[model samples]
Target: MTSLPEDSPPLIRDNDRDTAVGRLQEAYAEGHISHEELDERLHQVLTAKTRGGLQSALASLPEEDAGTTSTIAVAGGRIKRRGAWRVPRILKVESAYGTVRLDLSRAVIEHPVVDIELQLGTGGAKITVPRDAIVEFEDLQTGWKDTRYKTRRRPRSGGPRIRISGTMGFGRLKIRHARR
Candidate 1:
């Protein structure tokens, strides 16, 4: 990914009221945007004072003309699945502020992975792993009460030695070994 320069302008732009309204209408019609959606977007754009706010709203609502695959929500959250698991090689995880991943591990197969190296960006987590699992020490920076892990369920498969490292702000991470 191309990194934006520190001095570069923000992704969200402040649109003039009249021009923005016109574009909203045009996008609503030729773009086939619903009146309700357009109104919501208009409200967001109007209320947004900073470029970040404007950009966030725009990113959440994509251009009507451009779209590929729809998103399916899982575990009361939006999720995406990759290829089927085969011997469970390596799990590549990346995340930003306030986002969590791997919500289906406990729900799906029990202890299907043998090894994992978790490289987190900036976020908090509450994770549970099988008991008797060996974890390795890794280089990481974490915040106070940001990570909590615990294990309650019985162990199905021998959990891999998890090594986690990353920078965090304000959150809690919990890890515990569940006895199966």
Candidate 2:
């Protein structure tokens, strides 16, 4: 039921959303839309599959004032935070090796999940998860590099569930230092 304003900036299209994003960039450069507005509208532009679909797309983006905060910060990376709901701590990451430092961690836990996304633009990335939790996972992309995390020995008790997903565009995903 949500609709774009009659005067809303003509609207953006899926194929043209990129161009619209560029215009938004110009708008920001000219001090038209605030950073917050740009971030929000950008979300709409990306989520929208088509020009007409943009109205709803833009509307669905999480507002700064909204309870939840979701953003895609990098050139080819998007970080979406959904529901601080529950669970110890969950970090879903999508990036290349250049952001590997952001991926490494030294922690032990009963239940922990580290979701990693690798792109061809990436290299040497690994995730460290506690060995206490049960391990249950599936390969998103079939390949040797994607199994880097599977190299670790799973704990005997129900086996900690560790899920590692990879794509041809990415390098390798290794799960290391999983404390038992």
Candidate 3:
């Protein structure tokens, strides 16, 4: 079991709380728990200050429904995810001399946060999320040409979060929001 240090701060990240809430919601949606149970768990998750507390709040929940891993790899063609497609918890997109677009406005988001690993070469990748979605880009190592990116909103409550990290070489990575 992964446990936090005893002397460390009791505060947990918002992402953790959101994840716990998402689990409770999933349990309710799957009929694994009743409304009362979901309410109780939501309360506990919202008030959880430590990692142990958060874990306890989600202890009674079942594992998430596993599905096929969504991997989009194209060499000189356009790759796009739009409409009502299911958004995987972890997505991998690799493009070369092509364009990759991931639009999440009407997508089904099972997880509170989505992780993306993008490897681009001489191509471009565009991720279009809802206006309220939270996007965090990090560990972006670019070669030759630096990456050109922009985000308008910070990660906020009630909105799904997207964390993207990876490499781009002589390519472009654009993060834009869908018009409300």
The best candidate in terms of lDDT: 3
Report the candidate with higher TM-score, 1 versus 3.
3
- Candidate 3: Cα lDDT at 68: 46
lDDT of 1 by residue, 30-135 (tens): 6657889888877977887666655554553435332122222223232234223222334444444444444323433322223333444445554444355544
Q: Report the C-alpha lDDT of model 2 over 131-169, residue by residue, as the tens digit.
A: 444333464564445455444464554333455444534
Clashing pairs in 3: none
- For every model shown, what is its TM-score relative to the native structure? 0.35, 0.37, 0.73
Backbone clash tally (model 2): 15
Worst 10 residues of 1 by lDDT: 66-75
Global fold similarity of model 2 (TM-score): 0.37
- The lDDT, on a scale of 0 to 1, for candidate 1 is 0.47
Best by TM-score: 3
Per residue, candidate 3 scores C-alpha lDDT tens digits across 127-162 of 888777888786677777655556664644577888
Error of 3 at 163 (Å): 2.5
Local distance difference test values of all predictions, in order: 0.47, 0.46, 0.80
